[model samples]
Target chain A: MQIVLAILVGGAFGFVLDRIGATNPNVITGMLTLRRLRLMKTILLAIGTGSILMFGGQMLGLVEVGHMSVKAAYIGVFIGGLLLGAGWAASGFCPGTGVCAAATGRRDALFFIAGGLLGAAAYMATYPAWKASGLLADIAGGKVTLGTVPGSAYAGIWAVSGDLLGIVLGLVFVLVAFVLPEGIGGGHVQEMPAE
Target chain B: MTLDWKLGGILLGAVFFAAVLLVKPIGVSTQFVILDGIVADAVSPDFITQTDEGWTSTNAYMAKSSGKYAASAAGPLNYGFVFVLAMAVGAFLSSMLRGGVPLAERRAPEIWRANFGDTPWRRYAVAFAGGFVVLYGARLAGGCTSGHMMSGMMQTALSGYIFAAGAFLAAVPTAMLIYKEG
Candidate 1:
């Protein structure tokens, strides 16, 4: 039952991603370069809508907060994020979008997926050394949320409940998404280089 | 008709919310780890067993401890694996319905040509390198854009925000540097 649900949901997700033009490397790189603002608006809107529904569901006790998993914070995460960012800028495909692109029959995206698999295999091969390097060590209360807010929890800097704050921020995101100009990059469909 | 970006984005959010309600958080990277495990297992029967040093093997860790690990130690047949496969199928179906197969006649775009030139080898090389670095970094960071930035931030997790800041801080400058020509 769960597997079926996963496939359905994942399929829907992929369909949406493709429809938004996220499967296009040009669109992705354009967003990274601040030339195309449409994808950014789409991303922000998705995040905002998800945040509102998620937190709102939590407030209503319809959603289980425990079901939401939080990633751990460490110096490694930030540094790794920087690396991922650079990669995204260069390749214009993150893990998810890479898969989507490949599905759309882009041969380059297949190569990208192959590279990512090899990379993941390399990470597994060297896992012991990296784990012992202390770079992956958790810090600043790993898995922290706004409720914890690092050092500010006791000071009440984020006095509002995390869910409420999330809703407020989500609304702000929705507002920004609406206000952002479309066709900033002229919505030009650049022809892909012949394979 | 093609869905507009806003409606598509909202629909994505709705699907994500429903998925989270039904199962667990949505992510894509762990599927790669599961694939790695399956490949390793195919090469060796003892691929999943623990070593004498008490260190967890990749398969073991993926099966037992990874955040988005499968429901069982089923390797390639696991839930996460199936979900990712389904995602591909979905994309393919969408493309098919929209027209024919959405194969790219040209791989790179004008900006890429202006910056990186039209060498196929260079483009492929950079893409491979980029994929490797991104996955490696995502593993180290415990999440990728989808897992950390999207789901984590939706829940107001500080790590998500921090990761987003790092991603943008690096991505913007890198993009500018590489594609410097206006």
Candidate 2:
């Protein structure tokens, strides 16, 4: 039953990702290069909507806070993220969308997936070394949220509740998405029609 | 007809909500870890055990008995793997429905060609390098875009915001450098 639900949800997730033009390398690179804003709008909208639903649901008792998993903060993550960004710009696909692009029959995507798998294997092979180096170690309050806010109970100067703050930020994202002009580089660059 | 991105966002959010309600937050990088475990297991029966001390050692998250019974199962074939495989299948189906194939002869886009060139080998090489860097970085960071940017940000985790900022900060400049105008 759980596996079945996973398939259904994962499939739906993939479908939505493709439908939003995420499976296209050009669309992704365009967003990164500021040649397009569609993908940005899409991502902001999705994140904003998710924030509203997750936090709002929690506040209303419709969603359990325990279900939400927060990742830990560390210097490694920040530094690694900068590298990941460079990778995304270079390859035009992040890990998730790369898989989707492969499934969608993008031949280059298959190579990207192969490369990703090799990378994962390499990381595992060097796991002990990285761990020893403290590059992979969790630091600076692992699993922290706005509620915890690291050293203080409140985040920033407003002293708003964490959940409330999240919702406000989400709203801000939505507003930005709506306000940003579309097709920054003249118009949307359409990829070869699927095939 | 393809859904507008805003509508797509809502649909994606709905799916994520359902996933959280039924299972846990959605992520993809851990699936690679599971793949590594499976590959290791295939090569040697005691691969994971020897490397990680125990089957459950590296997979404590999946081994834990949670709200769902399937969550307690131990091994690489856990829920995360299933979800990722399902995503691939879903993507294939969606592509076919939209008149796309599982493989395209011409893969790289105009921007890629303009920046890199039209050579397939060059494209593949760069892609492989990019993949290596991204995945390596993701593991070091404990998550990738979906795990941190999507799921973490939704939960208002500070790491998510920080990572997102770092990603764009580096990506924009890197892209500009690579694709400098003539």
What is residue A131's positional error in candidate 2, in angstroms? 2.3
Every candidate's lDDT: 0.74, 0.73
Model 2 per-residue lDDT tens digits across residues B149-176: 8887877787888789888998877766
* lDDT per residue as tens, model 1, A106-171: 666777788888888777767677678887776766767776322222211255677778788889
lDDT of 1 by residue, B1-182 (tens): 34676887798778768777877777888777777766776687566654343324444345445423423334356556777888888887877676633333336545666666766677778888888988887776778888888887776777888889888899978876777643
TM-score of 1: 0.87
Whole-model lDDT, candidate 2? 0.73
Fnat per model, in the order shown: 0.67, 0.68
Q: Cα-based RMSD of the predictions, in order?
A: 4.2, 4.4
Docking class of 1: medium
